[model samples]
Target: MLTYYPGKTFLHRLDPTLKVLFAFTISTACFVFANIFVLLGILLFEFLLALSCGLWKWGLRSILGLLKLCALLFVIQILTYGDGDVLLRLYGDWVITFEGAEIGLILTLRITASALPLALMLRVTKPTALANSLYRYLHIPYKYAFAFGMAMRFIPIFAEEMAEIMEAQTARGVELDTRSFFKKIRLLMPLCVPLLLSSVRKIETATISAELRGFGLRKRK
Candidate 1:
């Protein structure tokens, strides 16, 4: 779940704006250096920080998908940026260069390091506190802040709904776990229809509720 977990940890006690600043600073600073060692250090720091907040397990689980994505990006970078000292030569001049691999590794680490801090913040900090901090400290409009928080809160809900839908379909004799990648994609495509319809219905209901509460017309000082 992306929603905050109530805790008495130091991270939970931190001001939302300070947490946002720390995440933003680390994420941005990660790109300022191209060194793999520095990126690794940042990644280590993130891991330690997550552990400090008692979120190491959740952080690892959350980042598994991201790790796969980073791996894919690393492969792409290695293939596309192969213009340096040859490390391993493949068939027909397809060479894996040392420089390319180094760059790919650094990029992957940087991306992962950049994402972890913000993910940790979202996991530990309440959405209402985040939104209020954004409105008060960052001067962002309260309506926009509320929408952002709601979107974050809804992500896990939508994911759970989709999983339930898939399970229901599987129970009804639908084969969704085929080994063939394309077949899996084809099977999954139909599931999106129901998810989209449900999302639209939810949006309609939320909009009507907000309107009833005069959410847009309320005056702010």
Candidate 2:
């Protein structure tokens, strides 16, 4: 699970605001430095941080997905932003240029470095603690802080619901994993109906519960 895991790790013990500041600092640094080596170092640091927090598996999964995105970005960047010496020839006049590849690699590294810290922070920090920290330290409105926490908590719940829906569909002979792109897309269409209905039901229930609890009745002091 990518959600918070109760643990005795250093990251788990850190102040929520401090962790948020650290993530912001690292993300800013990633954008500031265009050097590939610096970005690689930051990337390595993120992996090490994940390992220290016992979230290496989740981090690895995120990295794998990002890598595929980076590969596609590399192609797009090379084709659209191609300049300087040609690196590789494609069909006809198309070619991958050195400048394009360089820019693509840098952008990919920057994105990875920027995202991993926040992901790790959220995975380690409980949403309630985060909300409390925002309310206490940052003096944010209680309703907004609580809403942020609830939103974070719902992410994994929705993912689990979607997984269950997929499994049920698979058992009923829906071929969601088909190689044909359009066929797979067509198969996924049925999933939207159930997901949308469930989402609407959840929203309604939440709204009613919030009203009963007087969510916005009293303003934060």
- TM-score, structure 1 vs. true: 0.93
Give the per-residue lDDT of model 2 (tens digit) for 1-221: 55887898999999998999999999999999999999999998999998898878878888777777788787788788757899898878788888988999998888888988888889889999999998899998888898899889888988888888888898888987568978977888879889889978987898789889877787656
Model 1 lDDT at residue 35: 91
List model 1 lDDT by residue over 176-211, tens digit each: 766786787788898999999998898789879988
**Which stretches of candidate 2 lie above 4 Å from their native place?**
179-183
Candidate 1 RMSD to the correct structure: 1.6
The candidate scoring highest on TM-score is 1
Estimate candidate 2's alpha-carbon lDDT, on a 0 to 1 scale: 0.87
